[model samples]
Target: MTDNPTTERKGHCLCGAVKITAKQAPSHVGTCHCNMCRRWGSGPFMELDCGTDVAIEGEENVTIYPSSDWAERAFCKICGTHLLYRLKGSGEHMVCAGIFGDIDGLEFTSQVFIDEKPAYYSFAEDTKNMTGAELFAMVQAQQESD
Candidate 1:
């Protein structure tokens, strides 16, 4: 992650019901092309690993869905804007990159579940792509280490 201890980035949901603040700029930005992510956002879900340094303002307006045993997804109840995808085991929150008002230095570095990506749509940027199994293994290893 970049040393961004001084930057405090702010953002809000579509209806302005849920506001969020990140204490530092994201170190890495990535896309998930898994079926669940594609269905949830109608495309690859782009996100930034904000670690645990995020603050939410409209907690009451946020609804969370347990998308998997290992993860849960959160969205703004009013506008249905996807807010975050959190790892249940580690409590790592990957906030939707699209919601951030300032994305000046974030770099799209990876794409997960790449095997499930549709043929019709593709990104021009060369990224580190991992299949679903590879992604799961990486997460599992991380959880074990923690």
Candidate 2:
């Protein structure tokens, strides 16, 4: 498993109406336990940080929803397959891991909104966890540094 974004990865929606291409799909997976994520997927959202270099074919077959002030979610309109969770300003996509069949070095490494995670379920993997406030602060700090 690699810690860095190395190779290109491609995947499509359930109905094959839409395709996602990531120029640098990271091997690391980040889990989101925020309320919005859980409500969207019925559980934590496991995603790959596919940086800004992403292409979405069949744009006409997809739907985009502004989930928050800083981010938006997209899905295949044909099959309702979740496609992306992207940052507004950077246009950085954290694509749905489920869409990708099997990636070589994918591994669970981090998690956010841990405080909102319910007690009914837990992941066996050890991950770097951060609360909602911590996550927001971290992002803010990163943006400031940039």
Candidate 3:
């Protein structure tokens, strides 16, 4: 396994102004197939599950928008960096791990909401598929456990 504290990573916005740090690597990583994720991310949305080790120090330069009734999306105001998509009620965050330097041994495990994915594109890789309701339920269960 990769060293714990040494595995900490850094990520920055498109223009390199906004930066983020996470000491813990993701427990789960995947591409999201929801319409909002696609529209906001402009493609398959990559989400990293870092349980609160994620921290953004440059909040002044970022803009936040409520993308859904239960979530918020954050981006760099100046460079339009897709920073994070956090579920308000669930307390789960889907961060753009691309900004972070290549994480050694990192892997993409699953894809959620595959049924909602656009017809124009398809993923050849094997992944677990879950509907929106199922995904929401999973998140809710996690929150309750926490």
Task: Give the Cα-based TM-score of candidate 2 against the true structure.
Answer: 0.96
- Each model's number of backbone clashes? 0, 0, 0
TM-score of each: 0.90, 0.96, 0.84
Cα lDDT listed for each candidate: 0.87, 0.92, 0.78
The total of clashing pairs for model 2 equals 0
TM-score head-to-head 1 vs 2, winner? 2
Best by lDDT: 2
How many Å off is the CA of 135 in candidate 1? Answer: 1.3
What candidate 2 gets wrong by more than 4 Å, as runs, is none
Best by TM-score: 2
Per-residue alpha-carbon lDDT of model 1 for 32-144, expressed as tens digits? 99999999999999988887788999999999999999899999999999999998866778889988888787777899999999998999888889999998899789868
| Higher-scoring candidate on TM-score, 1 or 3 | 1
| Per-residue lDDT of model 3, residues 1-146, tens digit only | 23223256778898987888866756456788888888887798886765566788788998989997988989999998898888786566667878777666676568889779889988776667788889889978987899
RMSD of each: 2.3, 1.2, 3.0
Candidate 3 stretches greater than 4 Å from native: 1-6, 143-146
Clashes of 3: 0
TM-score of 1: 0.90
The C-alpha stretches of model 1 lying farther than 4 A from their native spots are 1-7
Give per-residue CA lDDT, model 2, range 65-136, as digits (tens). 999998999999899999999999998999998898667778899999999999999999888999999999
Model 3 residue 84 CA deviation (Å) reads 0.7
